[model samples]
Target chain A: MMDDIKELIEEGKFYFLNQKYNEALQYLNKALEKDPANIEVLYTIGIIYESINNPDKALEYFKKVIKIDPQHEDAIIHIHSISENQ
Target chain B: MERFVVIGLGRFGQSVAINLAKLNKNVIAIDKDPQKVEEIADFVFQAAACDATDEKNLRDLGLKNADVGVVSVGEDISSSILITLTLKEMGVKKIISKALSQVQGKVLIKVGADRVIYPERDMGERLAKRLSSPQLFDLIELTESHGILELLAPESFVGKRLDQLELRKKYDVTVIAVKRNVPKLKDDGSTSFKESMILSPGPDFEILLGDIMIILGKSKGLDKIKKVK
Candidate 1:
């Protein structure tokens, strides 16, 4: 199960780097379902949403990442950025 | 280090003295009010409660040897003029005076002030610009026609490569740098954001949302950029 989750994240990151945001979200969302508290998956999805200018959705994912891991500095920064823009 | 003699412990005078001292420069702050001088005594090299209009007192304080003298006697035109003349006659290298009006500024210049500043008017102008243009984060005026502006990346700029945007040809502006918050993986495996600056981004560089672009261009080009949604 852990291997599957890692593979899903790798696929998501690959698509993300290539600018295939929808494909990246699909893979990342699947990984998130498997491990709801996965920090990497949540952060990547937040990045995807932010890049696409879906700040509200991005904030949602980023907030979830922060709730799970308070030390997620990236998520905290994204939350602040999204809030300020709004 | 340059030595600065600041006369008049008004708000503007106090700020200049404190900032000069903070920069490790020698600052002598003078005011007629003992309370005002006492308030800034801890921050500057020397804070004295003395009448700045007295040339003898100024000469005694070695004002002639200072690199610069700033006269900021708020709302007291005669005192400001007297202080500027005193500093100039004492051979202060440069004299800056604050004025409440153009006429006062002109008089200060005629009385040997090297530069005249209108802090209140400048602050009001900045506030007006910020209120009118929400996208413009900050601006530094380089000349009457040119400036360096910090603004958010417009929506049309996002997802497009720098070369594709043709900003130089279209807007006559040069993108000097891009400020972004980039994600970083810490040694402990936690994720963090690092404030990064990309100086002189290449032609292939793509603009991302949330990026702050610092551009240098003429005022007309900057006004157009500000209007971009």
Candidate 2:
């Protein structure tokens, strides 16, 4: 199960680099389903949402990252931005 | 000399022409009302009273070669777009039309306005920010995320050099420039001064009395910067 998720994550990275946001999102979601605690997967989900102008959902994921890792500096700033813009 | 032909003579039109004129640019002020035309005569290179929606009148006034033609007749959306289309078709290089609503603005852009202005709405948004913020006085919103604004420095910066503040790390902002509203010392043997500005200032500068600084930051970053104050 872990091996499958790893291969999917690598494929997601390739799609993200190629600007295939939907494909990247598909694999990212699969990785999250396998290991929901993965910080990089959660952060990537937030970035994908933000790229499409969905700040509320992005904020949600960023908050989750903060809950899992309190010292996450980017999560702190991203939350600050989302709140201020709102 | 490039010329700006501002049509309508309404508040927005007048403001744009006056600001540009203050910048020492050539302005051709126009209005359908003779009184408005007379009011701005001295400030403009030329002032005239003419119906801007009328293509023949605009052509006769040599507005086609104008560097910009702003149609500010938002009271009547149809007239605004008509003037914009006329200006575009008449070979005016740039066309800015004022619109009362988003729908009106879209129509003007579709009809060939290079840009659109919403005076009442834009002012309302600006004033709303001022009303909500305890510290922010004026803002120039560049995007949803970015803005350059005039703000009072937080107490933390009362007597410190700008470099020490480290706004980028502390608050995620960049202080592009500092403005100190110090009084200018006149050519007198006595000690007296008049309120003035120093612009594009540097890190060596220290914040002082009556200073209204210009700051740049993300929208959220500014809130943190101000909140710390």
Candidate 3:
């Protein structure tokens, strides 16, 4: 199951790098379902949402990451920036 | 290139001179105060300490050949009027003057000023508008009842295609452009963002969160959009 989740994450990152946001979201959502507490998956999804101008969804994901791990530096910074702009 | 002569090196005059020079326009700034003239010497094509009210001094400076004249003697109504008359008599085609009040503005206009601006009052109005409507980013009045404005896309607009919104039929406003921050993938596999503008987006375009929409419409329609949550 761990190896499968890793593969899904890899596919998601590949699509994300190619700017195929919908395809990236599909793979990332699958990985998220398999491991709901995965910090990397959650953070990447947050970034995808933010890049697509969906601050509300991005904030949701970032906040979830922060709730799971308060020490998440990138997520914390993203939250502050999004809040400031809004 | 059009030559601009700006008289009086007050705050308003200095800003006008500096901005004109920045735009690659030929600007000659003149002021009675030598210190003010020295301060803006580097920014403009020419900076001279001379009494603009004296027709002889203005003629000596070759101001008669200037395409435009800006008389920005802030708060000194007499100086503004004098300079406006002098510039008009100098055969400057266009004269713009700064006035402290409507009465002064009227006098300047009668004294041959082509345009009179009240910067302080206009600035105060802009601040009040921004404070009242936080969603509005910027606004430019195209006419008395029409305006072009940049505003944050409202919550209800997210994820909906432009055709579905029917903004023209409903709000009577047109979205002329959309400004967005697009995400970019770096070589090192990190994500960054860059600002992009889509002018006259098609009907299939979808509204995204955090997008700033530049819309043009009548004031009534704009006010309605501003109230959107």
Candidate 4:
């Protein structure tokens, strides 16, 4: 099950790098289902949403990452940047 | 109006002081060169030929009461740094310094400069952006990933209404304004162009060819529109 989750995350990252956001979200969602509290997957999903100009969804995922691990620096920075603009 | 003290009489410093004065701000222009001071004496609220690095000279000019101070002596990095430090010590609330390099910029920030500007570097970035995207007339960066763009209307978007284009839903951008160039006959009977602007046109408004759109959106969304054929 762990190997399957890692494979899903790798696939999602590949699609994300290629700018195929919807496909990336599909794989990332699968990884989330396997590990509900995966901070890496949640952060990656937030980045994908941000790239697609969906700030609300991006903020949601990044906030989720912060909730799971309050020490998440990247997530905290993202939230600060987005909220500052708003 | 904010009180501004501009040090150094170089082109950059002179422009800053003159423009600030033109905006109705109380600007005190200072430099060591008497000729430079004389040239801008008529423009600013006060003009003086004094060493900006000397704390005594600056204190006599009441620099501590100025709301903002700009140190624009980039050619002489040492003098610029000293001036910046003097302004900070004199209780100036805001200090904007010009830096010749990244190292100087970091030093300025460490010495209490509120902002550091590299005119050459900034202009280079703007020129590169314009050269790469011919359609982009202007760009104002609001954040790292978002900005306001002025670009010519794409051929694909001609004759389409805002509602039909679905810009907000599809492209995730907003059209702030539209500028059209209209030809008018002068008194001597020669035709000249005049700009007509529409501020915040509604969804039913139609996009016309040759129109310039003022759009506000994330950089990704703007890039997507630029790629439209």
Candidate 3 residues lying further than 4 Å off, grouped into runs, are: A1-86, B138-149, B183-193, B216-223
Candidate 1 residue spans exceeding 4 A from truth: A1-86, B138-147, B181-195, B217-223
User: In candidate 4, what are the lDDT values of residues B1-229, reduced to their tens digit?
Assistant: 7899999889889999999988999999999999999999999999999888889999999877889999997599999999999899889999999998999999999998999999989878876876687577787889999999887888788779989989888779999999865433346432223558999989999876557889999999987887876
Instruction: Give chain B TM-scores in order.
Output: 0.83, 0.77, 0.84, 0.87
Candidate 2 lDDT by residue in tens digits, B1-229: 7789999887778878888898899999889999989988888888999888788998899887888888887598878878899989988898988888999989999999999888889878876876687356667889999988777766668677777877778777877765542222234311112334666667677765335677888988876766756
Q: Name the better of 3 and 4 by TM-score.
A: 3
* TM-score of each predicted structure versus truth: 0.65, 0.59, 0.66, 0.66
* Tens-digit lDDT track of model 2 for A11-69: 77666555455787899899999999988778767765554335678799988989999
Backbone Cα, N, C clashes tallied per candidate: 0, 0, 0, 0
Candidates in descending TM-score order:
3, 4, 1, 2
Give the better candidate number (2 or 3) by lDDT. Answer: 3
Query: How would you order the candidates by lDDT, starting with the best?
Result: 3, 1, 4, 2
Can you tell me the DockQ of model 4? 0.01
> Best candidate per lDDT, number?
3
Q: Categorize the docking of model 4.
A: incorrect
